[model samples]
Target: MTRAMGRLLDDAAEGGRITPDEALLLYTDAPLHALGQAADVVRRRRYPDNIATYIIDRNINYTNVCVTACKFCAFYRAPGHKEGWTHSDEEILRRCGEAVELGATQIMLQGGHSPELGIEWYERIFAAIKASYPQLTLHSLGASEVVHIGRTSNLDHATVIARLHAAGLDSFAGAGAEILVERPRTAIAPLKEKGEVWLDVMATAHGLGVESTATFMMGTGETNAERIEHLRMIRDVQDRTGGFRSFIPWTYQPENNHLKGRTQATSLEYLRMVAVARLFFDNVNHLQGSWLTTGKDIGQLTLHYGADDLGSVMLEENVVSSAGARHRSNRTELIELIRGAGRIPAQRDTLYRHLAVHRDPAEDPVDDRVHSHVSSTALNLVPVAAAG
Candidate 1:
């Protein structure tokens, strides 16, 4: 690394923010460990507690029937594909019961952009879940889905979000934001909404007092400049409204996907993204490492590379898992992963409040039943009859 670059990272580590150009340079020119060290230093300064956190949550993919056929995704089936199925209310409630039984504090309903499933469909499902599990956080939906709902229901983005919020939508999950830059976004998810639309929807939601995280899907043949551009887009929006709770960067799962695994982000690339995102997103609070996609070792390594959160135990993750994410962990293993990274493990809620800190390994909770991808009917793709 050049002395200038070293000084730049030093400034960032010492709490000085860097511009987008400087971040891109640091992300490109800096050595892996150099960036990791500087990023970890910044992380340590912010989180002096030396605690790396993980959440015990479930991603309940409400449906897999989508219209926008993003080439990189293997999970979405067309509107009327026989394999496409929507879970019945009883089935969804049963999964919620399982998540609660296994101690999941957050439940994310990751549905598809089915034209049939409009605003009323979402409201009914969310209301039913909230009615049954008022204590569980309804951290479901994303900006792209919000846009789809508005189009389907002929309502504005704000109206769609407000109604969903009233129906027990706790927070927006930053899904479907593969690469916010137009070039990569268009190349990868052409049918989805544009990057500006995603940003505007999130900004609107923030105005309405709803917050969300920002996720960037990496390794879809995007150039380094485009990657930095993606972060810049998010950071600009975040500066206006501090609605994004965290920034998560995960690699695309290439297997069983339409993109054909022709382009993939290596583990080193993923780590660089984690470090760069932490340094760049000074306004954002948390940075999450994608354990489910990059595997447990890289996930653990990310704790030292500027990631304060190891993402969720992911009691069930169908969308990514179907594409190639195979990593699974229960509460016990997740705590171990955090502790292995030389930090105390804390089970956090959706808002990132510490629910339980496993300071003592001897006292760690043992719950093996909370396996990820555990028995979701969609997990095996043997779709049940679609919900009416």
Candidate 2:
């Protein structure tokens, strides 16, 4: 490791946070292998041989009719458009039932910003879900949704988060945070909430005793400085509230989106960010590798770079599918991947509770008949039965 890289790891080990300049050095100057080594050291220090964790969850996009018109999102259709859709509560519950049957303990309730659905709409839906499947954890929405509800209802951020929490909204998914820099955020999602407002809402949520994860959308033509700036912003809030549980940074999927194929960040850049985030965000507890966007090999590689969590099996997804991300893996395949990376595989709940840990690498399942299917959305692909 370089002198600066060694110092950076030592700072994190000594409970001293690295400066933004140090973060930039790690992002730009540190050798890839050295960076991964430092990050793995940090991970081992935090979670020793505990196996990279994954959650079994389903992303239930309740609707796709959005008014925000984010330039990079292809999932939303304009209000009143014939193709726009909103799932009935029954349809949503059925999907939840499917997830529950599949041993999913978490449900991600997310969708576009529909003016028709107010705070009361969410309250009713959450109440219904909780009343029916009281065991399922609802890890839904994000700072942007909080901002939207507050603005739409003319209530403060605290009121919106408080009311939602009371209605059984468990935690924020840290979505809607494309890049926290004002320029890139405005360029991609101009009509949505401001960068500061996103953080403000999260802080409010944290203060209300509602913990959440913080996220950044990488590879959006942002400077390395801006990327570090995003981490700095989250770290500042974490210093105050101590409510962020994890930080996840994923590359932007460029295909079939409005931005029309802007330069995407390479795997090297993504891994560097992963390592830098681990080195910089000393307070945040977990770092997740987004295999869904980066593919399985890169996902396995990320375990060495301070990512102790592999995100989720997804069960179902639509947002990235709309943008042309096609990576898919089953539970057995995921376990093998983790084992192949020389780590044990553990199934975790939304709150990082270990439900089951597979220790014997020999127990990995082999399913040779598995085949990938192309879903209607770019991110929703699944398997189809063979023709008789």
Candidate 3:
């Protein structure tokens, strides 16, 4: 690391705030541990209690039929493919019921941009879910989905979000933001919402008091400068509205996708981005490590670096799994992983509120059924009692 970069890292670590250029330089030049150490300092300052949070949520991909067939996604099918499917309201409600039974506080209702589905489709589903599980947070969709739904329904994105929020949608999942830069986004997911449009929709949501998270899917042949630019764009918007609750940067899964494992971000690269995000997104409150896409070990290591959240104890996750993310964990193992990393584990709601904290291992809640990769929709066919 250069002397100048070292000083920049120190400044960022000490809460002095580094510019985007400084962050890019630190990401490229600083030693891994040093960068992580600086980020850890910032994290400890932000979350003084040394607690890492995880959410118990089920990602309900309501449909696989999509109009915006992004090249990087293996989860979405064509609009009329035989494999295409959309979950009925009854099916979705059942999944939500199962998730609630297993202690889930959030439901991430994601799907493709089917031309057949309009704003009314989402509004109906959101209303039904809200009426059924009033306590469960309906945190689903992203800017891209909003654009598709609005265009399909001939409504504006703002109206789409407002009606959904009125019907029960709490916030967005920050999915579909493969990269905020234009060139890479055009290359990989040209059919999806543009980078600026994504930010604009999120900004409008924030204006309406609906907070959402921001995300980055790295390793798609983007320049280091572009990565920093992505952060800069999010930071600029956040400076104006303060809507983004957290920033999650995850690696791109190359398997089973059009990218075909041609290019990918290394584990070291992932951690470097994590540290850099911690340094750059100073205004964003929480930084989550994607253990589901990356390995569990790297996820734990992120806690040491700068991440205060380990993402979800995903009661059910299928999109990344469809694209070849195999790592899975339940509540029991997740608590152990957090404790093993020398931090207290707490179950958080969609709003980042501490729903339950496992400070004492002896007092940890025992629910083996809270395991990941277990289908939230299949709990009925295989009873939890019998399955456990």
Q: Evaluated with TM-score, which candidate comes out highest? A: 1
Q: Clash pairs of candidate 1?
A: none
lDDT of each: 0.88, 0.83, 0.87
Pick the lDDT winner.
1
Give each prediction's root-mean-square deviation over alpha carbons: 2.6, 4.6, 4.7
TM-score for candidate 2, please give it: 0.93
> How high is the lDDT of residue 231 in model 2?
96
lDDT tens digits, residue span 295-359, model 3:
99999999988999998888887777777777878888788889999999999988899989998
Each model's total of backbone clashes: 0, 2, 0
Native-to-model Cα distance after best TM-score fit, residue 187 in candidate 3, in Å? 0.4
Indicate the TM-score of model 3. 0.96
Error of 3 at 238 (Å): 0.3
**TM-score per candidate, chains pooled:** 0.97, 0.93, 0.96
Estimate, for each residue in 1-388, the C-alpha lDDT of model 1 and write its tens digit. Answer: 7788878888988888889898888888898899999999989999999999988889898888889888887778887797788888899999999888888899999888998888999999999999999999998999999999999999999999999999999999998788999988999888899999999999999999999999999999999999999999999999999999999999998766667789999999899989988898899999999888999999999999999998887888887777777677776787888898899999899999999988888898886786677765435554222222
